[model samples]
Target: MPDETTDTTAVAEQRIAALAAAHPWVSEARLTPDGVLLVTPHPRATAALPTPGPLVGEHLAHWEEVYEWTYETAEGRHAGDLDLSGWRASDTGEPLPTAHMRDWVDRTVGLVLAQGPNRLLELGCGTGLLAHRLAPRLEGYVGTDVAAVAVDRLSGAGLPRAAFVRAAAHETETPPVRQAMEQVFGAGVRPDCVLLNSVTQCFPDLAYLSAFLHSALTVVEDGGTVIVGDIRHAGLLEDHFGRVERARDPEAADADIAARVASAVAEDRELSFAPAAVQRILAAHSRTVRMSVHARTMAYDSELTRYRYDLVLHVGPAPGTAAVSETRQLPWPGRGSEPLAVLLRKALSAGPVVLHGIPNALLTDAPDAVTPHDLRQALTGTDAAVLLDAGDPRMLAVAAPADRATAATARSLRAPVGRLAHEPLPAFVQRRLPEVLRDHLRRTQPGTVLPRIVVDDAPKGAVR
Candidate 1:
C-alpha cells in the first residue's frame, strides 16, 4: 500500500495552494522540499500594507483585537504555561534564547520584592507571567489586561491570592480598581506597588503613558512603587533598526540599510520614551515622586539589553531616597577614536560611570561598530556592570524615506507544515505570523526617533 501520510500531505498542500490563490493578499504559496511553507505577498497589496504612525484614539482597540486573537487562536496549545507567556522567536520562526526572558522576569520580580510591597497590582499582565511567579510571595496580587480571553484563562488558573481583571493600561477606574482592592487586599486598601512590565511599548504615545502614570499614582498608597519595566529607548531607535537591517542583509550597502531603517522608523507604531521624557512627565505629575532609570543586567546582548531600560518611581518618597553613589560622568570618546571595549573597561575599573552624548554608530558608515557583545566581553569576570543608555536628543537625525515600498504589516500565519489547509490564509497570517513578527520587531524598532547613547555603566554592583 502507498504511504497514507504522503497522500494526506499532498492533499493538504493542494488545498493550501488553492486557498493562497484565492486570497487577495497572497501572490503565491508553496511548500519547500523541507516542508516549510513560503507565501509571497501580492505586489499590489504591498502598497496597501498599513502605515501605522501615531495611533491616536484607536491604539487601545488595536491592542485588544491583537491580543484577543493571540489567546483565542493559541488556546489548544499549552499557551497558558509561564514559559510560553510572551513567547519570542526569530524572523525564521526559531525561538529566541529563553535565558534573557528568565533574566527579565527574575530582575523585575527582584525589583518588585525590593519595594517590599504587601500587595501588587500589575497592569497589562498578559498570561500572568509575572503574576504566577509573584503571587505566592505577596500577600495579594491583581493582574489586569485588555484581552478578555487572557483574563478568563488566567482567572481559571486558580493561582492563590491572585485575581485577573480585564482593563486597559490607561484605564484604572474601569472594572473599578477599588473593587479589586477590596477583593485582594482589605476594604478601603490599595496596592503598594503597581507594575507595567513590558507594557509601555503598546501605549499609543507619551500622553497615554502620562495619563496612566497619573491614574496609577492616585490609587497606589503613599511611598509605594511604580515599576515601568522594558521601556523602549527612544535614543537608540535608528541604531536598533540598523542592526536588524544589517542582519537581514549583511552584505547590503550602508545607504540601503539607512533607507530601510528610515522606512521602518516612519511606520513604527510602538511608543518609545526617552529616560529624560519619563523624568519630565513624572516631574510634571509630582516632584515628590523620586525616579531612577536602570539598565538591563541580562547576560545576553540582544535588542532588549541594547535598546531598552527600566524605570522605577518611588511615590511620595523622602528627599534623597533615590540618590545613588556619585556617578563619574565620562564624555563618550567618539566611535572612531577609542574602542568602546577599552573605554568601558577603564571606566568601570575606576568606579561607577555614566557616559552622555555619544554618537550613534549605525548613523555613520563605520563597519566595526562596537556592539553590546564587545562591551560584555570586556566586562567578563569583573564586578562592574555595563549598559547602553539613550544619548542626547539633538544628536539623532532622521533619514529620508526609502524609495522602495515594503509590506506595511506582516501577516502571521500559523500552520504546522500541512495543517493550515483548512484555515483561511488571512486568518492564519493574522493569527500566527504577525504576533511573532511584532514581538521580534517591537524590541528592535523604537516607536520614536531620539538621540543615541553609547555606554552607561555602574561599578561595585550598583546597577546590577
Candidate 2:
C-alpha cells in the first residue's frame, strides 16, 4: 500500500496544482487551519497570457488541452472535498484579484444595489469571484458549475450568504447541482437577471449553446433581463497581434505567418450569431431586445477588444389582451389649423359634417401635418365628423356648377385646404355628398345653397 502520510501530502500538492491550473490567477493554494485552501500570489504576477484560439472543429482539440490537464489531474479530482470557507485569510494576504478578472461582478453588484436587493444566480461562478463580490448586495446568491471541486472549495470558504451547486455545463440532469440550485433560489424563485459572462463560447457547438440560453430564459421571471457579455472568437492572439519570425527571408516569413493567422481566424472561428438566427430565436420567446458593443481591454489579455452584449428584456402582454397597436407618426410642421377639427365641430352642431379635401401635393401635406393641439381646437365644438379625404378627381366631381356656393363656404374654414384638379369625383363620395349636405341643411335650416349660410333664422322650406 502507498505510504499514507506521503500520499496525503502528494495529494494535497496535486490538488493545489490543479486549482492553480484551472484558475490562472491562483498562484499558490494551501490548506488553512480550518481546512479551507488559501490561494496566494495572484496570477497577475506574469504579463497577460496570449488569447486562446477559437473553440471549434479542429481548433477544439487545441482548446481542450488548455482545460483538460487542469480539470482531470489527480489533484483536480479530489479538490471537490477541499473547502475554503473556513479560512480566515488568503495566503497572499492580499485583496481579491479584481484586475485579472472581468468587471462584470462590479457592474452586477451596482445594478442589484440600485434596483433593490435581488436574488441572483450566477452560472459558471468560477472560483466565486463574482459571487463573493455580489453577495452583500443580494437578498440571496446561488452559483452553479460543473466542477464538484469548485463547490467543495466554496463551501469551505465560509460564504454563508452564497450557495454553490455542482452542475456540468449542458448537464442539467445532474442531481447535486440541480437540488442545490433549487434549495437556495427556492422553487418559486425566478431570477430577475441571468448573467452569462464569457461563458457561452465554451460550449461545443451553437446548438448546445442555444439550448442553455433557452434554459436560462426559462429560469428568469417575466419582465426580467438576461445580460450576456464578452466577445466571441476573441481568443485568437496571432490574428490580433502580428508575429515576427526569423527565417532565411525574415520579411517573407512574417508575411506568411500573418497570412496563416488571418486564415486560421477566419476559417476556424466566428461569432455565435448565425445571421438573423439569434433575433429569430429571441422573437418567439422574448418581448424586447436591446444590444450594444463596448470597446474594452480584457482583464486577462490586457489587449483591446470589443465587448458585445445583448440584453433581452421580457415584456409579455397581459393574458387575453390583444397585441398593442404600433403606429408612430411625427406631427406635420408649418400647418397651423386642422380641417378635421372644424369638421368635427360642424358635425356636432349640425348632426354630422362632411369634410372635403383635394389630393394635390399642397393639400396632401397640409391637413395631415397639422399639430394635434390645433386639430383638437378646431374640433372642440364638434360632436361627430367624417373626412372627405377626397383626391382632386373626387373634389371636382362634388363641386358642380350648382355646388359653387357650398365649395366656397367650405373654403372659408380656417383649416388648411388643397387645390383639386378638374376631374370627376369617385362614385361613392359623389353619390353620398349631396345626401349628406341635404340632411344637414334640413336639420339645421341653414341657407339652401351649396355653401349654405349658418343663418339663425331662415325659412325651413326655402331650400326644399
Best by lDDT: 1
What would you estimate as the lDDT of candidate 2? 0.38
Q: List the lowest-lDDT window of 10 residues for candidate 1.
A: 403-412
Quote the lDDT for 304 in model 2: 18
Q: C-alpha displacement of 14 in model 1, angstroms?
A: 53
lDDT of 2 at 18: 51
| lDDT tens digits, residue span 307-332, model 2 | 12222223233223211221111112
Q: Candidate 1: lDDT over CA atoms?
A: 0.57
Q: Residue 322 lDDT in model 2?
A: 18
**Superposition error at 336 for model 1 (Å):** 20
For each candidate, what TM-score against the reference?
A: 0.61, 0.42
lDDT of each residue in 321-417, candidate 1, tens digit only: 2233344445545555666656655544544444433333423344534443344455555543333332332221110011000000000011111
